[model samples]
Target: MTPKAKAATGALTLASAAILGAMHLWEGQRLTVYADKLAGGLPTYCSGRTQPPRPVGSTLTQAECDAIDRQTATEYGRAILACIPAERMDQNSFDAMTLFAINVGKTAACNSRAAHLMRDGQRENACRALAYGPDGRPVWSYARGVYVQGLQNRRRYEMNWCLKLATAA
Candidate 1:
């Protein structure tokens, strides 16, 4: 990355963490609680469409989708926490992981070999695990390696900033 991009990423990372920490400090559990209330249980990325060509559940109403994203985000977060690749992850790590999982998918994110390597404590080798695609396939195939590396880099930044905060505190 260019020096400017790196610097900007650093700034953005800090800002994101500060916001999350502030929310937790002020709202305590309200953040997740409100999200759950809005979800209404059936709130999912699928809305109500159980299959393709079926707009019935493709997208929910605005309120429902918003609530669904929140609820799914929280539920997805719990799964990540239970099986994080690393033993010493902080909330930042978990947040980064959760956000990625939410964006991509829980099953896809956690089952990555790169993720497995990360959990095994091989952060660098884990990065190498980021192949363009397994078996010479394109990212369109199973590019777990590529995305997991990105997630690792993000979590590393979060982990570093978190450590700095802990030390300062």
Candidate 2:
């Protein structure tokens, strides 16, 4: 892969938006209302580590969302750079891990199986790590005191993308 692809800074930015869209947080900044009627605010540009700061009525414009998304990606990208050596992983793996980091929080992502695998030059397994739980069980994550499958699906998609990159030298 080229240096640009290995860095994958642009891919990370785009993937962050994709994750938000998949979670139905793409209509600007608004509350995510699940099928079960559970509600939670998910800001487009996350000022907080876990979620965006709740806006007035939990809403924001497209431009506002775009700005926040860029800022958040930059913030998370820096965190990813701090721990994970930039050249150690390919673009697909780095991008997937960065997106996961953005969703799961940088602190957790940096300490995750994916991070460990990548650091040890096990890029393929790093991508696969996204599909498993912290303990290698079924993928599941808690949100608002309830388990949500959105994360699991997102991780799986990322895992596939990372795996498609093929083995590195």
Candidate 3:
């Protein structure tokens, strides 16, 4: 990898810890697999992971959950950094974005207005985009067409974290 790429990777690695911590707090730990009715009954377990589908009764140890969470966060962080210049993001912003991507999906986060703003060097606006869209309404704050306070809260948290270094911007 080029020096720049290596630097980005190192930065992401440092940010991953904060991302995982936030994810654990937000997603919560479920030892047993459960059907997420809001997500069309997707089988989810271990920090909201739905991949490698397990039966509803499947269980995992704390160690397994931590490992999965780290792996998933790392994957999402790398994908996000691929689209937004890692050099443009501070640790708080990177952590917030990574957590948002984990919740909303890499493709959505990467294509979001926030990503556009970040790529355009509008760091503060990019952070604000996570909570409010172009129409000045909360984005990604719905589930099954119903407004969810939890999602709104999550967005607010991310937006705050993303803006932590904005004064320096």
Candidate 4:
């Protein structure tokens, strides 16, 4: 790789690591939380082996859960980096994409409009795309607009991080 490309890759790697750290700080390591199936059906404790999916009628200690969380998130972050192959990324964009990849999957993250926009050098638009749901709409609620908010808020936070708050520090 050229020096500039190598530099961008290094920056992205650093930013992704920071992003994962921040994610753990925010979410904590849940020993048993149901995640939606990657193939898209219902939310379940078992989605894939990449995540520390809890088995049916199984129990786990805090240490085990934490280890699994770190492992899974690291794997997802690396997948995100791999998906972007030759693209140059800013720190904020890298952080946003890393977090998004961890939440969504590598396939979705790689194929997202946000990813396309980033690749096309329309980063501002890519940040906006982070707020869009899989349906390509902005408002996504877990419940019936009451008692619970959802991924939209998370997406908005990511958008803000990418567009304004994310930094090299």
Candidate 5:
């Protein structure tokens, strides 16, 4: 091969390798962050003998939030993951679903239309099926909408980041 042609090919190969390495590093970082966040904020649950933080009718504090977050993240997260046919949720869904689980509790989200579609192995349909607002727009709660739009936004950003990483990987 000509000298110039050989040099150009070598450069391109090196660039591709570098890009792949960067992507791997990025995905690793994101996954670590996701796991760490869940670990740090996960809540504790005791049996009926133990008193719940609120005594069944009170607002939650940081401790309660932590307890609930941890409990739901584990219980609901596992249940949702099990129902999902995919071996993994592609990080975006992991963070999204876990956060959603933490907020609305497992039973609520697990029983949702989105959950059913997801379990049925309908990803595109499930994504479209998720509703976070009222009157057909993102809202604050379930009085009208699905009530988890904010976390859905978080999932969007996470998925975009993953895609960018994929291109490089």
Candidate 6:
């Protein structure tokens, strides 16, 4: 991890290494701004930031990208800590939810059934809620109202990580 990455994770109460690792694995680095079809063709760059939008052709250095990623992670961490009791959650579970928030957006993740379950002291169920809802149907596995395999795979990965199970390769 870079110094910025360290500083970013330092502000969070959850497990830093795991959270950063998951973010890297899921978000992937993109120094050049590009349209994200899944996000309605919004111009995004630097590990998925869309705010303070950069033009599609804009490019950033690796250090610049890392800095942006760190800032975004810190902001998301604050949001997660505001709603969830990070101190009480196991490292893996908190890490999993942080990744989820990164993917879904802070408000939505904080307002999700998973968050509700965590707040209500249902840890395991909250983890399960990452992929399935009360109806035992998949959730957060769709893009533009259509089921997406990539999203399903991500949810499954998150669910497994939260449960501390062996993740699929």
lDDT of candidate 3 over 57-132, digit per residue (tens): 8899999998888878878888888888888887788888888898999999999999889888898999999999
Clashes of each: 4, 0, 0, 0, 4, 0
Give the TM-score of each candidate.
0.41, 0.66, 0.90, 0.67, 0.42, 0.86
Judge candidate 1 against the unseen true structure and give its global Cα lDDT, from 0 to 1. Answer: 0.42
lDDT of 2 by residue, 1-169 (tens): 3467435543333334444443334123433321223236443333233353354344456566556666665567668767787777565666666667767778998998788888888888788888875577645255676766865677788788778763534
lDDT of 3 at 45: 92
lDDT per residue, candidate 5, 75-154, as tens digits? 54455555554333444444445444444456776776666766776555454445432245542234233444544564
Please say which candidate is ahead in TM-score: 4 or 5.
Answer: 4
Give per-residue CA lDDT, model 6, range 1-169, as digits (tens): 4676545444334336666667778888899999999999999898888999899979999999878877777677767777886544665777788889989999999999998898888888988999998899999999889999889889989888888832423
* Cα displacement (Å) at residue 116, model 2: 0.8
Per-model RMSD to reference: 13.1, 5.8, 3.1, 5.5, 14.9, 4.7
Better of 2 and 5 by TM-score: 2
> Considering only N, C-alpha and C atoms within 3 Å, which residue pairs clash in candidate 3?
none
Off by over 4 Å in 2: 1-52, 56-58, 133-136, 144-147, 166-169
* Off by more than 4 A, model 1: 1-59, 123-169
Against the true structure, whose TM-score is highest? 3
Candidate 4 runs further than 4 Å off: 1-8, 14-17, 25-28, 33-53, 85-87, 133-148, 165-169
| Model 6 misplaced stretches (Cα beyond 4 Å) | 1-15, 165-169
- Candidate 4 residue lDDT tens string, 1-169: 3566456467555434566565765454444544543324332331123333345445566676555655655566566667665355667777777777766668888888888887887778788888864566773223434422446677887788778734556
lDDT, residue 85, candidate 6:
69
- Ranked candidates (TM-score, high to low): 3, 6, 4, 2, 5, 1
Worst 10 residues of 3 by lDDT: 8-17
lDDT of 1 by residue, 1-169 (tens): 3566335333222223443443233223221112222223422232221112322223345564445444555465655555553343434444555554544467875786645765886544433343323353223122333444433444344334433322212
Question: Better model by lDDT, 4 or 5?
Answer: 4
Please list the C-alpha lDDT of all candidates, in the order they appear: 0.42, 0.60, 0.85, 0.61, 0.40, 0.80
lDDT of 6 at 70: 75
